[model samples]
Target: MADNNLWHETLHDHFGQYFAVDNVLYHEKTDHQDLIIFENAAFGRVMALDGVVQTTERDEFIYHEMMTHVPLMAHGQAKHVLIIGGGDGAMLREVSRHRTIETITMVEIDAGVVSFCRQYLPNHNAGAYDDPRFTLVIDDGVNFVNQTTQTFDVIISDCNRPYWSRREPVHLGLLRRLQTLPESRRHFCGPKRGLLSAAG
Candidate 1:
């Protein structure tokens, strides 16, 4: 009877504290990545990879909207759009907002990133993945740009900095290929691509 009573007391003490806190950091690990999802907290959830914040529970829209809309509005009428390296699909979401866009082609190197964003970062990408107007081509942006004859009214490069030794080569190749498309008005954005002077 004494042991039973002690067990009951311990259970009450332990389980009782669980409900007191409304939120906690739940650590989750997978074969491909490790993530910490903020549960019942202000930020809801975020995917952290290699100690870097990949996406957050809130304010993703603000970033996406600002990145895409500013240039799009400046162009006035963007019927066709091309996105390079934005596997997150948030840019596509903002791009689709413009009614003038007839087609949007997104070139993503990693399909896994897109899949992960669709599943885990739904708040950021939402249902933009399912939109018919958004066409995803799982290919290198440099190669895709070089081979394609299709021109875009606006081209948004969402790639990260060129860390690879061949990055400049790829960038030059893409730029050279883009120059051949006389109809398409090119607009280069993002960190690495933005560094090049207009004369270069």
Candidate 2:
């Protein structure tokens, strides 16, 4: 609980949903964005990237599981999984739980987010970084999608919320490029490709 009447709130004006903080645990401005880990009496540990709430320890499982499982399940089977911009590794952790998954490649643009999540918001990652099936690539996700010869059964986007920035547009363009890949092994179906975003 807050010592005083003071409250640190993350207000999502569009959705009219706000998360309140009781205590601040960690706050840092990385090269990319401002990252904050705070304590909430109701939500446990809460993380915010660039002023938008990413996840709360109390409900992180729900978000991560849905982000990972729903897509993998819908795809029928996922052997090679590609994650883009999930520096917290929550999505990777959930993806690695499936033994059927042969390999997991996680591409996070910001190394700082990865290191910070490992150090302070460790609960989100849960040491999934050490999993044998997991591979970490610290580079621009757009570049990876555009240049990599590797293909995947599933792709996940777990980026920070858009704050009137170019990240989301660039990512969307990257997805478009992914959609245009060669028909044979690009997606499950040949000639037509399906695109799904975890934006909502």
Candidate 3:
């Protein structure tokens, strides 16, 4: 809730940031999390999940580009890509830019996030959801990482830190699973592969 049109984000007990809301576009308690989309004079539009700012229209490209492009570019010959938990679709939009990628599998736990973002954040996603190469799976990323037998030349873990009580961090779980995979199937994750890891 915004008091006097100011939305305060308490990043920590001692530090935070606030945005002046120009308009409240949408608000809902989704099946999986709390979601809000509001307009800010400076940010243009702001989307927050579970009371934390996720993406803003003004500067989303910086994050989406870096996360999607850096890894794919580094991989050089990446054809298949897996994205774990980028329901907002900004990451999808960026990844779709690579013409060489034949398939993009995105696993998102919350379908509501995809529904809302697709409707409200059109600029961010830019119809990437409708791309023929995209395949969206409404499932937990941890389960996908553990159970899937498919191989990807590049895998992008775009999940937020876990908010559920006592659940393992999403990326950590993926890392653990990756560690047990045979070296032949371990694509581009470790330091030896010249790719940055979330583990460190």
Per-candidate clashes come to 0, 0, 0
The lDDT for every candidate, in the order shown, is: 0.59, 0.74, 0.83
Write one digit per residue (lDDT tens) for candidate 1, span 1-200.
01221111122324411111133344455444454434324445554433334445665666677778887777666777888766667788888888778888998876766776676667666677777788999888888876776766677776543232344644466668665655443433222232221111
lDDT per residue for candidate 3 within 1-200, as digits (tens), equals: 46799998777558778999999999999998889999998999999888778889999998889898988898787788888888999999999999999999999999999999999999988999999999999999879877777877777888866344366767778877788878776754433443422311
Candidate 2 lDDT for residue 147 = 76
Tens digit of per-residue lDDT, candidate 2, span 63-109: 78988888888876668888888888789889988989899899988
Candidate 2's C-alpha runs over 4 A off are 1-20, 163-171, 182-197
RMSD of each candidate relative to the true structure = 12.1, 3.7, 3.1
Highest TM-score among the candidates is held by which one? 3
| Per-prediction TM-score to the true structure, in the order listed | 0.63, 0.82, 0.89
Q: Supply the global lDDT for candidate 3.
A: 0.83
User: Pick by lDDT: which candidate is best?
Assistant: 3
Candidate achieving higher lDDT, 1 or 3:
3
Candidate 3, which segments miss by more than 4 Å at Cα? Answer: 162-168, 182-200
Q: What is the lDDT of residue 47 in candidate 2?
A: 76
